[model samples]
Target: MSTPPGAAGKGRSLSAVSRDRIEQHLKFLVGVRHPVAAPAALQRACSYLEDTLRALGYAVDLHGFFDGGQEYHNVVATRLGTRRPEKRVLVLAHFDTVAGSPGADDNASGVALLLELATMFKEWRPELTLQFVGVNLEENSDRDGHGTGLRGSRALAAFALQQGWEIEAVVVLESVAFAGGSVRQAAPAGVPLQVPPNGDFLAVIGNELAQGVVARFALAADSFDIALPVVPLVVPDNGELLPDTRRSDHAPFWDAGYPAIMLTDTTNFRNPHYHEPSDTLETLNLAFAVRVCQATAAFLLGMAGGEGAAPS
Candidate 1:
């Protein structure tokens, strides 16, 4: 991928991410994060995210919404800014896993990275308030594939809309671990952009309006010592026509006319265990996950205009 202008000078190093804590969160979340068969397990996962954010000194809020006659939850924790409190930047992930699967790489990895971001920025007061969110029902775990995904994000977006929250940008964390040099990555039969032959890369998927956010993340990660490859993919204004691009929580923000991007390892493009039971923690590249988290922290801090933050 071509580096953006002055990308080398952006973002902080990857020193803030703790591999041990990431492993702990991944083990705990992947072990009990199946939201379809067991609702209690899903609740526990949300609780864990809430408590961790709270302990990290963020003001937490629980927003409840219903879908399919069932109540689901979204946790929004704010690392209140000392400067521009009205301006906001969001980082979020779905805590709910697919049915009968552990979802280590499918989602637990993203949630773990969210927590790591919270830990890294606990003491730094940024200009834009960072709303760390844990959304629910992102997976069509009920086996109903017809417009069932992104319920939680839709709800959160609705809340943001009704409240007239001035969201600067949103970073939706998705499947971001697992990598290899295999040539199994494939897009639609005749997609416009090129899908790299190898799966060892993080795809920064976004729409036209989100190109700025995508470039910011790539630049932030580039400043660090990370070796992982990043592929920036910008969808057209009519990206809704593409099924592959709308496969995550970030789509809801795009639908709401808000700029957003998804950080992920192309789901099922290289991972054989998309929603399968074989998606376990052992299969994840924890080091790669850490790099993604580190980059995200830098991106958020830079966007928020935090003190000691790198150039955005």
Candidate 2:
């Protein structure tokens, strides 16, 4: 990948230390058993995220609720913006993994990226208030047996609407660690590929409402020397779908009538170990993860106007 003009000699790239942190986070997730019926492991993961946010100077809030007599909580950390409060930008990633899989690439990768970004934003706030949300129940619900319903994101969106919160753009980081053969932007079943095969690049999948947002994010990604495939398209209603677009935590945001996009490594379509017991930390492309995080930080900083702005 070509290096951006200004990013030639910036601070250290996400380091070995950071990669180690990501691995540790994945290890923690794999060590836990977060079933759909009872989510004790999910709660523990939330606690870990909460502590990390607190250490980064964010006042974390737990939106706790009950469903089927089981407690579900979404961890939210807010950093006030220096310029715009009414207009906010949301950075979301679901913390809860699948029922049985270790989910290293399925979602722990996304959560690690979120935590890393939280650390970066704590030092440099954005012009738009930034809300980092770690959602629960992205997996199939015991009752509905549907993963696309997105119980946690739906609840959060409803609550935000009720509270009159203006969400300008929502960016959902889904899977970021695994990398394999060329990456392709997979649309729903019968839909054409939005972009080319280039697994080294990030794919921004969204609808027409978020087309401009996806463009801007792609520009920012390019500015950071990140070659991301920005695919702005509508999802088809077909039941059979490409693996990349079919599985992720971003679908909820789009379903809620908000402008949202998912950043992923194409999941099962590209990763051989996806959703399998062998999906361990050793299989992750740490270099790709570091580059992805760097690109994400650059995009946020550019959107916020500079590194001096407080993280929103």
RMSD of each: 3.8, 4.8
Q: Compare the candidates by lDDT and give the number of the best one.
A: 1
lDDT of 2 by residue, 1-312 (tens): 122234333342323226666667677765333555346776788889888888889879998765566677889999877677677778888876655567777688888888878876676646677788888776655445643546677788777777888777788887788764554334334556545555565666666666767776776656545443444444443112544464555565565667777787767656777667777777888778776777676666655442353322
**What is the overall TM-score of model 2 with all chains considered together?**
0.83
Local distance difference test scores for all models? 0.81, 0.67
For candidate 1, the per-residue lDDT at 50 reads 87
Clashes of each: 0, 9
Model 2 CA deviation exceeding 4 Å by range = 1-17, 36-38, 143-149, 181-188, 194-198, 227-247, 306-312
Alpha-carbon lDDT of model 2? 0.67
The residue-by-residue lDDT of candidate 1 on 80-117, one tens digit each, is: 76677888899989998877688999799999998888
